[model samples]
Target: MIHIVFNEADIPVLQQAISLDESLQGEVVVIRDDYAVGPLDHTYAGEGREARLNWWREVLAGGDYEGKTDTGEVDDFKTVAELVGTLRRNPEETIWIWAAQNKHDVSGYYWLLHFMKEFQGRVFILYLNNLPFLSEKGQLFYPIWLHSIPPKEFLKAKKLARPITLSEFEVDPDEWIRLCQEKKLVRILEGGKKLSQHDADFYDIDLAKFITVDWQKASKIINQFQHKNKHTTGDAFLLWRLKKLISDGGFDTQGEIRNMKDFEIKLKSQHQAETA
Candidate 1:
């Protein structure tokens, strides 16, 4: 059996789970790209893939991930092709896809399911949607990410695995394709497999609320936003949006914007206060 997960941080936790239960042992494969954001039209094809990568490049430019968006590093297409090849070569082999309740994992599941239609019965899913687990402190909590679950708890999570149904194979892929056609810049998990789409600047206004006349590090503002916001996005994307806010003269900045720590931002009103 092969284990597939969407988040990189979950890899070690899953490995620990496998260690506790030898019955669950398998090689873990991580799908690196976050499908919850950016373009998804024809992503399975070369032209569309390049277009998405180019978009990432634009987002990452002058930020922390600049020049780190190499195709080889973030190639989910290649990873899927290899997994498909493995399944074809060994018919007896099966796969287990693990996903948490968050949009990141669900969106990944949607994107990945499109490619696994042929191996319907062989593909299994363990979705931890609305499921409660015991944390290290022995407190009951519903985790949004798999890594938050203790290794011992995963032994229980493994029991939730079930083969991808024939109905799901037909229906889920259509759902993913529909999302691709919608071409929305953001996808938010409403509940279960349901996702709602929004425009690119959806978070811009809320993000602005965190800004003040008092200067703060770019990282500090992003940290506060993530802590307070119900729907959280990646810091790189938020930082990119911050640059956009700055460019639009909505905010004032000091220092280079190459990285979060390299710059500080404040409300444009601060400039008026200084002049007065």
Candidate 2:
């Protein structure tokens, strides 16, 4: 069996889970790209892939991830092709796709569905949507990301697996195609397998809310925003947007903007003078 996950952070925990239960043992492959953001035009091959890579180059320019775009790290198409090759060679091999209740995971799942149609019964899904699990403190809570769940909790999650039905194989691919056609910069999870599209600046308002007139490190503002908001894109994406906000003159900045810790950001307002 082969295990597929969207997030890199979830990899270690999943490996631990496989260690605990040998029955769950399989190679965990990650689709590194965050499908929730960026252009999806012809993403699978040819000009579309180049366009998407160009967009990523633009987004990562002048940031920490700059020049890291072509490192062959974020190739979902190659990953899927390799998986298909493996499946074709090993007829008995099965695939388990694990997804949590979040836009990132769900969007990744959507992007993968189209390619898994040929593998029908061999493809299984374990969606942890609205499912409650015990934390280390023994309190019950729902997890938004698979990495958020303890490794032991995955034993219970594995039981939720079921084959991707024929209807879903047919319909879900259409849904993904439709989403790609829309080509929205952002995708948000509305509910069970449903996603809503938004503009690139969708999270700008929330990100700005964490900023104040007082100068604070960019890292602090980003950390605070992530802690306060339930739904968040990754830090790299947020930082890209933050730079956009800065360029738009909605906020003021100090120091270099390449790395989060290298810069300070504040609201665009005058400071009050202290009385002697």
Q: Which candidate is the best by TM-score?
A: 1
- The lDDT values for all models are 0.91, 0.90
Worst 10 residues of 2 by lDDT: 267-276
Q: What's the C-alpha lDDT at position 225 in model 2?
A: 88
For model 2, name the residue pairs that clash: none
TM per candidate comes to 0.96, 0.95
Local accuracy of candidate 1 as per-residue lDDT tens digits, 1-276: 999999889999999999999899889999999999999898788887888999999999999888878747888988999999999999999999999999999999999998898898999999999999999999999999999999999999999999999999989888888998898889999999999999888788888889998999999999999999888898888999888888887678899987999999998785575774
Each model's Cα RMSD? 1.7, 2.8
Each model's total of backbone clashes: 0, 0
Question: Which regions of candidate 1 fall more than 4 Å away from where they truly are?
Answer: 270-276
lDDT for residue 60 in candidate 2, whole number 0-100: 89
Output the lDDT of residue 194, model 2: 98
Q: On residues 1-276, what C-alpha lDDT tens digit does candidate 2 reach at each position?
A: 999999999999999999999999899999999899999877676888888888889888888788888998777888999999999999999999999999999999999988898999999999999999998788999998899899999999999999999999989988888888897889999999999999999999999899898999988999998989867888888999999988887677899988889999987665421221
**How many angstroms is residue 80 displaced in model 1 relative to the true structure, after the best TM-score fit?**
0.8
Candidate of highest lDDT = 1
